[model samples]
Target: MDDAYDELLLRGRVYGADHEDPGPRPGRAYRELVGGPLDGLLLDVTGWDAEALATGAALSTHLGRHGGEGRSHYEPRPTDPRRWDWTADTP
Candidate 1:
């Protein structure tokens, strides 16, 4: 998995699962990149829930990289979704 994606998963483990229909959280970072103020914007997940988006954005910002700049670098190698263990039988 990409480093950033791994990092996100780690954060998710530490934080929590993303809420369904993340909404404007992803778009907020996109807008910042579109405005050209974000020279190194990276979007790890093109589509993510609000919680995931918020967590990613906060981490990226603190790391001093634009939220969009790391998208391509990390998204291609997504963490094994199965690792999340969200199965119907799990409950």
Candidate 2:
């Protein structure tokens, strides 16, 4: 499985299983990516510190360098809560 799917399982978030819409576990917070390669993917920020949460993270993606792989950089939007805006892609 890919990193994202693996992460979901690791977070105990099962889709189409016992619960129809098993959202993020209680106490788990997430930020949704608004654009770029990983758009619409929910980023779990349950335990992220203030600095890290504000700076966002470099997420992995399968679309870069001849369509092999790459990393997408995102940062929290100034006016949006629990949302990250795509900045750019990196090799």
Candidate 3:
């Protein structure tokens, strides 16, 4: 499981699951690195204080990373985060 996903859950920030369709990804995966695990990160900071959210919402080429699947007691999780990112992000 990706640490980012766990961190999101720990803070109760994740809102819902949005999985990528199955397919081959060209170049770098937008949500996850090529073949990276996680359908993609979907953490919402809408409940967070303005300061906290703004700090993480910076504009940068290195902003996107891998995450999406949950690994809690009943959360939907993939076998690996590295491979999960390989799936298509959209249909």
Report the number of the highest-lDDT candidate: 2
- Those runs of model 1 whose alpha carbons end farther than 4 Å from true positions after fitting are 1-39, 57-91
Off by over 4 Å in 3: 1-39, 57-91
Positional deviation of 51 in candidate 1, in angstroms?
0.9
Q: What is the lDDT of residue 23 in candidate 3?
A: 31
Tens digits of lDDT, candidate 1, 1-91: 4677444433331211245533234232231121122232333344677555433332222222334332211211134321221111100
Q: Write the per-residue lDDT of candidate 2 for residues 1-91, one digit (tens) a residue.
A: 3587446434553212345764565555677777887676677787889999989988776663324467888899999756688888887
Model 2 regions lying over 4 Å from their true place: 1-23, 64-68
Model 1 lDDT, full chain set:
0.30
Shift of residue 82 alpha carbon in model 1, Å: 29
Give the clashing residue pairs of candidate 2, or none: none
C-alpha TM-score for every candidate:
0.19, 0.68, 0.21
Error of 1 at 72 (Å): 15
> Cα deviation of 78 in candidate 3 (Å)?
31
lDDT (Cα, tens digit) per residue for candidate 3, span 1-91: 4687444444331223333433322332222222222223433333556444323322112222412332211121245422112323221
